[model samples]
Target: MGHARANGDRRVHHRVDLDGRAVVFQRGAHVGQYALENLSAGGAFISGERELRPGHLVHVLIDFAAGNPPMSMTGSIHRVREADNGVSLAIRFPVLSADQEDAIQDAVLRTLLRREEQAARLPLLVFEPRPRVRQEIEAEIRSFGLPVTSVESLDEAVRELEGEEVEYAGLVIHSATHDRASMEVVEFFARTESLQTIILPEPDGELNDMAKRLSTLPHVSVPRIWSRSELRRALRN
Candidate 1:
């Protein structure tokens, strides 16, 4: 649902991209369900409902993975925004106990660790058409400590992939699998069997059917937001 810290970002903790359903509550009553976008030890952001306000205290149950029990937490809404599709929430948690903080931080760390392990110790290729958007995303990738080669067109990415001098960690793009050209490249990634890829839908977009299917592949990640690129830098162990 979003990207992370640019320059001058004062956030003390780094956020990891997470996919989950948040059952929200207020005043000890069930409120509604929302999509959990990203999370850190300090707080998290959720999108999809318009019935909340800043400073509102909420209790949430996060059903993150299939097998694990939902995590319950209490937080205060620090900010809110009206997005192209719906309202987004910024929830700030108060100071947690050492054990509580450790558990939360450890969980967030594992998410980034898992993603990087899938495409570790190698460079990355980012394909984006818009110059401004590409630059913003480029900086975000670099923040993760991966060497990135950003291209403005698919043709450029094609040439880079065909070359033998560099082995890429993965391919990052913002597109749906329904697009013929995009599908072809992702097919190539699967065919190669050695590459990994990440697909981020357009800012105001939802994932297409084919994209969801392709996400089942081990080398593919279809997360709505970029994983915390600054976990190591921002989190204190």
Candidate 2:
């Protein structure tokens, strides 16, 4: 069993406890393979020899097992602590591409679902005004074998949430209009501490301001969703 200790951690993204292997490289040269103790879309904790120091830039290839493709990304060591056997290095991915972020989210979600079989079928609530965007998000969530409740308007989503007794795994909101109705829906979920809220804003649109404001709330993520992969990553987060 993996142990999780978020006692004093102040990370924006939630970390999922997991165990995996990753190949660490520096300057295009192979450094060593280490054991990944915990992971989130933004960062990870790797245990290995205390060779890398804080602020050391490196590329990592994480193997998620079973036939899943390895996830590769560049990051810097944020912190390092001495462990019983070796050292635990906190690696932060300052810049993660949409695909890379999605891969990390997928791996973390898989581990979480596996650990809690009851949550495997948890429903995801999606509110997007655009038909194309709504369909895209619904398809991606369905691909994970989870149920999705997609609505074109914030009012409909709020009605569904209030009417249903189902526990949602997360909520994705993409509003191009960012009208008062949408802000109310965002505020509703913001007050609900149990749900993870993700806002996907259109580039250079009014939604940007709302995204920024909502991002200040706890368990809320505002990722730039200019492309499909980016939207998928935001939804997963």
Candidate 3:
């Protein structure tokens, strides 16, 4: 099981590159106005009007200074809380290959190693979620882009996953009503291939409690996100 360190040794946290311009994805659209705070090879945290519910799925766009056009990646919401300025979200990316992860880490490390590197540019971004999250996360997604569907039940969600001809790079499982189903899904994927699953705690869930619930689960990884660049970096990592 992984443990969240106290304030002193947040080296991993420091790796996050936070500038004002990172993309903000909340609902179906990208909110280009929200400012970024920090980012790492794992995920990102951002400032925005609406609060993202835990366990939601999101796609992030990152255009770091080292690269040309922004690239997009998928991630899952790990935490969302009310802060003094606005709502804050901590996300983790699950759809990444070893080469992709290495590339992202190299990109982030290069950006960090350079003293004069400009802040990474970010895309307006588009956020889409499985139907269950539409009501709570839709407003946030609209700030990014529109979704393919609004699936509200397990049967619908399964159908959506099965209909696709491509192998998914990631999966976001809500820890609400589908807790058992989510676990079963993860096991199913593990038996078939190398799939990374992001387990989101229900809204209002304490991080400590959420961590414990997800601990010991196989084929899962968690990263605290603060920027779109960070989310992209995570995909490469």
Model 2: per-residue Cα lDDT over 1-237, one tens digit each: 121233123235688777678899999999998888888767889888756889999999988753457888889999989988788889998866556667776777787768566565678788888898788878877876678888887668777777667777778777565676677667767777456787766765345566677778887877765556675676555
lDDT of 1 by residue, 1-237 (tens): 132432113236778777677888899998888898988767888998565889999998887752334678889999999976788898988755555566666667666776666556667787888888678767877775667888877778888888998878777776642366766777677667546677766555466766666667777766554444322221111
Reference-based lDDT, each prediction: 0.71, 0.75, 0.51
At residue 54, candidate 3 shows an lDDT of 84
Which is the better candidate, 2 or 3, if ranked by TM-score?
Answer: 2
Q: After superposition, how far is residue 197 of candidate 2 from its true place, in Å?
A: 1.2
1 versus 2: better lDDT goes to: 2
Q: What value of lDDT does candidate 1 attain over all alpha carbons?
A: 0.71
lDDT of 3 by residue, 1-237 (tens): 132332112223444563434565656687554455656656767667767678988766765655523546678878988888687777676555445455556666666656322212211111124544544443432333322233555565555556655334445444444545545654566446445444444445423444445545565544453233333333333
TM-score of 1: 0.48
Worst 10 residues of 3 by lDDT: 118-127
Model 2 residue 78 CA deviation in Å: 33
Cα displacement (angstroms), candidate 1, residue 214, comes to 30
lDDT of residue 90 for candidate 3: 78
lDDT of 2 at 53: 82
